[model samples]
Target: MNTSLKLKLGLLVFLLVLSVVTIVPSFYSATPDWWKKYMAPEGLRLGLDLQGGMHLVLKVDLKKAEENSLELAANDLKDTLSEQSVSAIRTPSVSPDTVIFTLPNTSSIEQVKKLVAEDFPDIDTKIESQEGSFPRIILTLKDAKKDYIKKHSVDQSLEIIRNRIDQFGVAEPVIIRQGEDEIVIQLPGVKDPKRAMKLLGDTAQLEFKLVAEPAGLNLNELIEKAKKSGQWKDGEDLKKLNRALQNQLPSDTTISFEKEVDPQTKVERITPLLLENKTLMTGEMVKDAQVRIGGTFNEPYVSLDLTGRGGKVFGQLTEKNVGRRMAIVLDNNVRSAPVIRERILGGSAQISGTFTHEEASDLAIVLRVGALPAPVDIIQNMTVGASLGQDSINKGLTSGVFGTIMVIGF
Candidate 1:
């Protein structure tokens, strides 16, 4: 052979050897200890059509999604009314479709109507009752918004799931909307499908609610009352405690507990806290969340970049509620309830905790995907074998190897 041809043959032989070394573990069930330690130990990952994998059919809770959206709107409406200096009070009972807050009088009625017309066009406003001087103004989501919510929920779920898979290093996942309120996902070559599902199907709700100060009691006193309650056995019956103290709590507030176990004693301590119904902000307001090494300790934290509107809202919330405890809530549990010492403006915030790099990265991913309130019911979850058959896959692999060999021979 000429010098150039000899060089080409050598290069081809090197590539073939490298391929064989890398793919050896995939072809054989058991690989040599030396090969595994020195060569590619992961082997080749086959596609869904070639290897067995997990398949899932998810049903989106459309109605629940609408309810969550309405809840958020009600909170925002309360904030807007407060901003406008409009006095209002909550009703005894509220429905998911309606926001019942007593306006001062008929004079404020027109202002609220005008506000809804201009600001919240998706909500239809009306006076449910004009008893006494104050009118009970009701705002319901329009049919158009109800329809939009269904569509929006599906789209949002798909985006969040895709973002999660991409972050966690899943390759070639087939995620698509199946129907009006369903999604079909085929995760190829996922060894631990349930773990992957847990990662993708987390419906954790993130909210910023002001820790409550009951009419006659402060936070300290509330915790004391909880500690002395009948449900304080072992400090685990949070629901029972809530039921025991529900009548004593102020309206539009609920108690949540955070559990901490002492490493030395192995004893658990339950810390009870009260949070209000109005969410000043939520994950939707977070434009992006990233893991960063900052602060005085140079530890890992999740840094949040808020949207323009969210920043303004957050600033106002902190400014108006100075000296009050604002809780960073996740799934109805308080992560941290810090005192709002100063009026924090700007669009940036930080979730500070003693977190390892992995924990912080996972939290960043969660925040980035946003808190998807719409719960997903896995209607179908099963492992599926290759539709193309093992024989076909082997044949395709053989064809590819042979084609490479033929090219090198030429």
Candidate 2:
């Protein structure tokens, strides 16, 4: 061969070898030990449709997040007025986007308007009504502010879900914000689709609240009353229970439930518990969390290590309420309510529940990463099986082979 021809042929052979080496792993499930040691370890990641996995579309509850934000703002307004020596006759009533409060006099109303204008510029205040001698003022969250909250909630949910998926060790996940309030996630080659779905769907909102002293009122009695009034059933839904006890619940307390499935009856039961709404700490201050087995029963539990500030705050909380019971709440469900049992320092805590190893691990993962900004509902869940995915691969390969053969013949 001529020298130029020889050089061209050698270059072509080298290129072909490199291409085959890079592409071989994609076709084969298990490569030779030598190949893995020398060649690139990564292969082409197939999509959910090709590899068979879980596809989910989640809708972010931006409205609830907005209402929560407004409620916090209303509480802050009340605190600010109290600090300014203008005491509101009653606690501010928070609606979808408005906070309504009654002041003792018109002077207090002017002071509130001035304070809100200066500090809470995103809220517009108006005279709502006059009750006896008190003037009720309404502080409506501005439209622009509400829109911002909704947009931010969606974006925050997307990031939190992405972080969770990354921690779950999905090789290549497709997590994207689909629309104004929807998130799309695709997990390829997920061995446990149900586990993945549960991990993705959990809101993981963790809170530490002091259990109400005297326990407010017996929620079972309230439930029974509702049942007698035809407002509840034997297994009443959470929304109906909340509505039934809305006025009966103490102003400073809220109601949550612990869910358990009877082993014998196989029926799910929710036991209601009254808890103070004031959160002493939240998962936002969590530094790290890990799954650990209890020394006694080998039961799985989540151990938490809080941030420096969190430790100080927690220490103070425990120290002040040494004899009280504090509830560990997740997603409005009371997981445990244990007596403070003296001051707990060092910022270390444990969450013990009826959890399997996998459940505990997933809980630790979410807590380590952080809670979702807003709750999410799975609007769509589609699982593709391995057999279907293999079929797809087979058809793609057959087509490719035929195309290659035709090209060679031509």
Candidate 3:
């Protein structure tokens, strides 16, 4: 061979070797340990349509999202009033589109109306029914505001779900808004469809609220009554129970369930707890969450780091609420209720519970990814089997090999 041809042949051999090295890992499940150290551990992955995986269509609960948005706006409005020294007769009560509250006098009502007009222009204030001498001011979200909330909610859920799936190690997940209030997700090569679904659909809304302990507020007795009466269904039991509890306990408090997993038997139990409706801090303030191994018995737990503002607020909350139990709630289920001993500063918190390492890791992933903007309801679920993928691979290889031989022979 000439010098140039020799160089070309050498380059071809080197290319073949490199290709073999890269392909071997993907070609075999039992790859050599040295290949992992020297080359990429994982090869280029096939997409869901090619490799077979789970396909899901989810609908965002826009109504529930709207109600949640209303509640948050109401809470913020209530805080603003307190900050401005404009006292409402009670905390702002939220409807689907309205925030209703009463002021003790015309002065307070005017202040609130002015505040809404100036700061909350998207909100329209109406002086409605009266409680004795006080006037009930209704704050309704504007059409434009409602539209924005709806759009932002779907977009927000899309991004949060994408982030979560990315953290879940899914290589090429197709997460897109399907329609006005629906999302489509295709997760490729997912062996555990149930776990993926849980990770994607779980709202993971985390809130820290003070445990409401009132005189004669027997939560156990209330739960017993609920159990005795099978009239309530569809998780509407919670709404009815809360309404009943409000007749006895403070309106600012509601009943929540604490999920406890027995370490020895690995059985799950739910215990009722009365928690303040006011959320002192939310998962929005969480800067990071990690799974840590610690404890007297060395258990896995999710530890949290908070933002600066969140840290300050948490410190203040713990300081003011010392000797009272603060409930760490996720998705309406209380994880732990620890009495504030002193000020828990440093923006750090540990969610210690009876959970396995995998569960703790998943918890950390969701917490780190932050809560979903809204909950998702699955409309369709399809599992793609691996046989199709194997068939595709076989056909592709046969065609490729046959074409290569034909080219060389011709």
Write the number of the candidate with greater TM-score, choosing between 1 and 3. Answer: 3
Error of 1 at 339 (Å): 2.9
- Residue 302, model 3: Cα distance from true site in angstroms: 1.0
Give the true-structure RMSD of model 2.
3.6
* Candidate 3 collision pairs: none
Candidate 2 yields a Cα-based lDDT of 0.82
- Give the range where candidate 3 is weakest over 10 consecutive residues by summed lDDT: 88-97
Alpha-carbon deviation at 21 in model 2, angstroms: 3.9
Q: Give the local distance difference test score of model 1.
A: 0.79
Task: Encode model 1's per-residue lDDT on 28-84: one tens digit a residue.
Answer: 878888897789867787777778787899999998888777766777777798899
Measured against the true structure, the TM-scores of the candidates, in listed sequence, are: 0.73, 0.84, 0.91
**Model 2: per-residue Cα lDDT over 273-366, one tens digit each:** 7787667788988999999988455778899999999999999999999898888998877877889989989989999867779999999999
Over all chains combined, what TM-score does candidate 2 have? 0.84
Best by TM-score: 3
The model with the greater TM-score, 1 or 2, is 2
By TM-score: ranked, best first:
3, 2, 1
Q: Stretches of candidate 2 above 4 Å error?
A: 3-7, 32-34, 79-95, 102-111, 127-135, 215-217, 234-239, 259-270, 386-389, 399-410
